[model samples]
Target: MGSAKWIACVSLVCLLGVLSRGAAAENDFGDFSLSRSEWSSEYMSLDSGHFLDRKLLQVQPSSQTQLLAVRGDRRDPLDNFRKYRGGYDVTNKHYWASVVYTGIYGFAIGVAWLLLGALITLGACFKLCCCRRPKVAERRSRAYYWIPRILAFLLSLFAIGVIITMFVRNSQLHDRAFKVRDSIAASANDATSTVRNVSNTLSNVDTTVSKYNIEGLNSSTLSSTVRNLNQQADSIDNTVDNNVNTINKLINGIEITLIVLLSIALFLVVMGLLSALMGWRTIYFLIILLGWLIAALTWILFGIFFAANNVTSDTCQAFSEYLATPSNTTLDELLPCVDLATAASASNVVRQGVNNIVAQAERSLTQIEQTSAALGRPVTLPTVCDPIGPAPAFEYNSNCPNGTVTLGGLPGVVAPFVCAAEPVTQACLGAGQFVSRTNDTQIRDLSSAGQSLVTIIPTVTRLTNCSIVYNTFEDIVNNQCPPTKRALRNIWIPLLLLSIALTLLSLDWIFANHRNKKERYASGRDPEAYNNVPK
Candidate 1:
C-alpha cells in the first residue's frame, strides 16, 4: 500500500509536469493564460487582482502614442488647462510643465503678499516716525477701540487652529511617506528573493544533471539555460538595488526638508506673536518682515508638493491602465517578458534527462537478472516504466505492463530478491550487488531529479510570465496610489492655508500695535484725553 501511494504521488507530479509543458507549448511566453481562479488564489494578498478582469493578460498598445490614442484624451479641460494646454497629453512632459507652472503661480502669489506686507510695514513706520501726528487726536468710538483688538484676538486664535491642523496633516504625510518607502522596499525585496530562488533552483537542476550523467541527454542546452537565467537574475538584483538606494535617498531628503520647513514656519509664527504681544516695535516689524519671507517659502513648498501629487495621480492612472492590458505597451520595454524558448527548453531537458536515467536503469536491471539466472541463482528483478511516450503523453497511469513493475514500486519488488538470494557463488554475489546498486542509487537519483524538475516548471513559468512585476505594479495601483495622493494633498493644502492665515495675522498685529501706540501718545498730551480713553 505504501509503495502504491508513492507510485501515485510520483505519477501525479509527472502528470502535472506534462500538463504545464503542454500549456507552455500553447503560448509563446509560456502559460500566461491566468484563469480567474488562479489569479484569486495566487494574488489575493496583492488586493489588486479584483480590479482586473479576464482581459488583464490581453496585449496592450505597442507604444506610448498608441496607448494614449487607445485611452483617448482624458484631460479635464478646466483643471488641466494652462500655458501648455495644447500639449496636455497626460505624459510626464505635461505633468512636469504643470508642476513648473504651479510653482511659479505659488511663488508669484507669495511674492505679492510679501510686497504688500512690506508696503504696509513701511507706511506704518513712516507715519509713526517721519510724519507729524495731529495736535489733537481725533475722538474714537468705543466700537473702534475694541474692534481691531477683537479682530486681532480672533485672527490669532484662527492662526493657532490652522497651525495645529497643519501639524496633524504633516504627521499624516510623514506616516504615508514612510509607508510608501516600506511598500516599495518590500516589493523590490520580494522580486529579488523570487528571482534568487529561481536562480538557485536552476543551479540545483544543473548540479543534478552533472551528478547523474544520464545517457543520451545533452548538458549544453541545460548549462546555457542556467547561465542565462543566473545572469538575468543578477542583472535584475543589481537594478533593484540601485533603484532602491536612489529612492531611499530621495525620500530621506524629502522628509528632512519637510521637518526643516515646518520647524522654521512654527518658529517664525511663535516669535511674531511674542514680539507683537510685548509691544517691541522694532522687533515686531522685523518679525513681520521675516514672516512674509517664510510665508512665501511655504507657498513654494506647497506648489512643489502639489505638483508631486498631480504627477503621482497621473502615473497611477497610467499604470492602472497598463495593468488592465499589459502586453505590447511601453511598460514592456521597461520590463520585458520572459523568454519562452529558454523556459521550455530547460523543462524539456530535465524531463528528457529523467526519462534517460530511468531507461538506462531498466536496461542494467535486465542484464543483472539474466546474469543471475544463468549462474544458477536465478532471480527476477523489478522493472521500471517504459520511456515516457510523446503521444498519449505520460499521465497518472502507474500500472506497469504484464511482466514489469511501476518505477516507484521497483525498490519494493527488488527488496525480496536481494534479501532472499544466497551468495552461493561469486557470480551470483556480483549480480545481486549490481541489482542493489541500480535500484538503491540510480533509480533513487532518477526520482529525485523528477521531483526537482516538477518544482522547476512552476518557478520557470512564473518567471517567464512576468507575474512578479505584474503583481508589484498591481499593488502600487491598488494599495499605494490613493493614500500617497491624499497624504501629498494634506501636506500642501495645509501649507497654503497656514501661509495665508499667518500673513493675515501679521497685518492684524501691526494695525493693533499702531493703534495702541497712538492712544498712549495722545493720552500723554492731555489729561482730558486720558480721562476720555476707555478702560
Candidate 2:
C-alpha cells in the first residue's frame, strides 16, 4: 500500500508540472496570436496584407486602444452650444453674430451712458450760469438735504468694493493666461522633440545602411525610403515649430495687452473717485469719458474671448472624434498621418536585407566547416538561424538546427575557432578573413540599424497621427477651458459693475456741485439768515 501511494503521488506531481507548462505555452501562443492579429488589422487599411508580420511599426497600438476605450461614443462639438443657443447652428456664423451683437450693444450702452451724464452736467451748468432764480427762503426738509449726500457716499463705497473685486479677478485672469501658455508650450515642445528625434533616427539609419557591406544585401531601396521619410519629418518639424511660436506670441501679446488695459482702467477709476470726493467737475467729467471708452473696449474683448471659447470647444470635439477613429478629418491637413505603405516597404527591405546577409554568412560558415573537415582541422561551428523561408523573414526561429547562432552571436561563436593555435594554412587564412568580414560589431550595427528603422515607425506614426496633440487638446478642454472661461467672465463682469458705479458717481458729483452753489448764493443774499439755513 505504501509503494502504491508513492507511485500515485509521483504521477500527480508529474501531471501537474506538465499541465502548468502547457498552460504557460498556451498563454504565450495566445498572446503571439493576438499580437499578430492586431498587426494584420492595423495594416489592412493600408492594403499591404503581405507585410502584416511587421509588428514593430504598429503605430502606438496601446495608446490608440486606450483612447478608443475612453471615448465610448462619438460626440458633436456644437451639441452643448446648440442646446444653450436654442438649437442655433454654432458655426462661424454664430460666432460672428454674437460678436457683432455684443459689440453693438456695448457701444450703444457706453455712448448712451456718456450722453446722459453729459446732458445732466450741461443742465446743471446751464442752471448755475445761464438760468435766473428767485431769491426766496429754502423750504426743503433736512432729510431731503441729506438723503442725496448719504446715497452718494454709499455708492462711492460700493464702487470701491467693485474695483477691488475687479483687481482680484484680473489677477486670476493673468494666472490663467500664463497657465494656458505654459501648457501649450509644453505640448508643442514635446511634439517638436518627437519629430526631431525621428528625423535624426532616419539620418542615422541612412548612415548605417551606407556603411553596410553585407554580401547579397541590397540596401539602395531602403536608403531611398529613409531619405523620403527624413524629408517629411523635417517638413513636419518646421510646421509644428512655426505654429507653436505663432501661438505663443499671440498669447503673450494678449497677456500684455490685457494687463495694460486693466491697469489703465483701475487708474482711471481711482482718479474718478478722488475727483468726486474733491468735487472737481472738470476732472470728474474727463474720467467719465475715459471710463466710457474703457467700458466699450472691455465689451469688445468679452466678445472676442467668447468666440475663442467656441472655436476651442469645436476643435476639442473634432479631436475627440479623431481619437476614436483617426481617418477622414480636416485635422489631417494640419497633422498628417505617416505613410504606412512607405514604412512597411522600408521594413520589408530591412528584413529581407538581414535575411540575405544571414543566409550568405551561413553559407560561408558551411563552406568553412567543409574546408576544415577536408583539411582534417574539423572546426565545429554552431548553425546560424535561417530567417529566409516561406514564413515571415523577421520572425525569430528558436528551433533552428544545432544550437541556433544569431547574427549577433556569429562573431563570438567564430572567435575561438579563428584564434585557435593550429597549423597556418589556406583554409585557416580564409576562415580568419571571414571572421574579420563578419565581425560581431558589423553584424550588431546592421541589427541595430534594422531596429532603429522598426522603432521609429511607431514614433513617426504618433507624431503624424497627432496623438500627442490630441492629448494636449484633451487637457486643454477638460482641465484648462473651464477655469479660463470663468476667469474671463470674472474680469468682464467686474468691469461692467465698475462702469455702472462710475456712472452713478459722476451724476452725484454734478448734483452735489449744484447744491453747494445754491447754498452759497442763498448765504450771500441774506448773510444774517445764513445761520438759520441748513449749511
Candidate 3:
C-alpha cells in the first residue's frame, strides 16, 4: 500500500511540473499573437562584436529603437604592432622586391652597360695597336655602393618610425597600465594597513579576552602568541611598502625611456641620412654609441625582473613558516600564527570581547538619553550622526588649508583616532559624516570582530601583479618573465645589430679616399689591366 502511494505521489508531481512548465511557456508567448506582436528588450543591442568583447547593454524605453554601445581599451601594444606590421607589408617579399628593383634591375644593369661600353673601347685600342688607358671605374663603383647606403638610410628611417610608434603606444600602455598598478598598489597598501590594524586589534582583544577568561588560554601565553603574529605582520608591511615603491619607479623609468628612445632614434636618423647623402665619414661612428645605449636599457629591465623574483621568494618562505607547525608546540602557544593560512580564522574570545564592548556602548547611550528625558530636556534616542560641521581644530594647530576632503582624515584632526571617539574637522562630508558616526559603526565593529575569517588576500594580488616576485628573481631560470621583456629584446637587439653592420659597411670610405681612387687608376696602380701605354 505504501509503495503504491509513493508511485501515485511521484506521478502527480510529474503531472504538476509538466502543467506548470506548459503554463510558463504559454505566458512567454503571450506577448506575441497571430495578429499583434510586442518587443520588450532586457539588454541593448551590441553591433561592434568584431572589435570589442562584451559591452554594456543599454536599457531602452518602449519608444527607443537602438542602444548605446560602450568601448573598452585596446590590446597590448606589441600585439597591435604585429598586426600593423603585417598591414603595412613589412615582409621579405617587399624587402627583397625593393632590393631587387634598386640593386639587381636598376644599379646593376646600368653599371654593367657602362662597363661593357668601356671594355669595347679598350678592345679596339688593343686591336688597332693603339693602347689606351684602363677605363675610369671610380664613379660607377661609387654609384654601385650607393644602393647599400640607400638601404642603410631606409633602415634608419624605419627605426625612427618604430621609435615614434613605440612612444605613442607606450604612452597609451602607461595610461592603462598605471591605473592597474595604482589599483594593485592601493590593494597592497590597504592589505598592509589592515594587517597592522588586526595586529593592534589583537593586542587589545587579548587583554579583553583575558579579563573574561572565556577560554582556557593563559594571558601571558596569549600575549606571546599575539606578539609573534604582530612581528610577522610588521615584516609583511615593510616588504610590501618597499616593493611598491620599487615597482612604481620601475614603471615610471620605463615610461621615460620610451621618450629617450624616440630622441635617440631621431638623432640616429639625422646621422644616417647625412651619411648616405653627403658621405659623412664621422657620422657612421655614432652608430657604435647608439648600440651601447640600447644595451644599457635592456639590462635595466632585466634588473627589475630580478628584484621582483627575490622579493617573491622571501615572502613565500615567510608565509610558509608562519603556517607550519612549531616543534613540540601546543595549539594554545600559536593561536593566531597557527591559523594564518591563505584563509585565517579568528578566535571566539575576540568575538566575545567585541560583543561585550558594543553592549556597554549601547547601555551608555541609553543612560544618557534616559537622563535627558528625566530632566524634561529633548532626548534623541539612537543618536543621529549629523556632523556639526567639520571637526573643531585643536587650540595650537592650523585649520585645513585651501581644500577639503571627505575620506581618510580631515586636515586639522589629530592622528590615532577611534570612530566616534574624536570630533571630525573636515568640511564637505555629507552622508559620510553620518556614516562614520552612526550607521557604519556596527559594520566597522563587525569587521573588527576577531571571529571573522579572511583570505590571505594580499600575497597573491601583489605578487602576481606585474609578476613582481616571479619575474624579478624566481622565474628567470624558468624563462617566465613578462613577455614584454622578450618583445623589447626582439626590437632593440636587431636595431643594435643593424647599427654595427652599417658602421662596418661605411668603413670602406675611411681606407680608400675619393681623390686617391682616381689617381691610383690613372697611374695604372688600380690593377685592372697590365697592358703598357705607349708615351
The best candidate by TM-score is: 1
Worst 10 residues of 3 by lDDT: 12-21
- List the candidate numbers ranked by lDDT, top first: 1, 2, 3
Q: What local distance difference test score does each model get?
A: 0.53, 0.49, 0.34
Candidates ranked by TM-score, best first? 1, 2, 3
Q: For model 1, what is the error of residue 489's alpha carbon versus the real structure, in angstroms, after optimal superposition?
A: 2.9
Full-model lDDT, candidate 1: 0.53
Query: How does model 3 score by TM-score?
Result: 0.37
Clashes of 3: 9
Off by over 4 Å in 1: 1-95, 99-104, 114-138, 141-146, 211-218, 332-440, 519-535
The count of backbone overlaps in candidate 1 is 0
What tens digits encode model 3's per-residue C-alpha lDDT throughout 224-331?
Answer: 545654565565556445555555665577578756755665665566556555655455445534533443333333333332232223222322332231111111
Backbone Cα, N, C clashes tallied per candidate: 0, 0, 9
State the TM-score for model 1: 0.66
Residue pairs whose backbone atoms clash in candidate 2? none
Superposed Cα deviation of residue 337, candidate 2 (Å): 4.8
Q: Could you tell me which residue pairs clash in candidate 1?
A: none
1-535, model 1: which lDDT tens digit per residue? 2211110001100010111211111211112121111111122111133322322433333332224112223343345553433222332354345444655657777778777877876897798898865444556776665665676566666666777777677777667766765665565565556556655664575555454444323344455655665666666566556555555566667667867776776776666565555656677667767767777777777777775665566556756776766544434333344443444344455445545556655665676577667756787665766434432223222244777665455556555444223323455465444344433454454455545554554454445445665676677779887887888787778778877777676677667556555444442477357556554
TM-score winner between candidates 2 and 3:
2
TM-scores for the candidates: 0.66, 0.63, 0.37
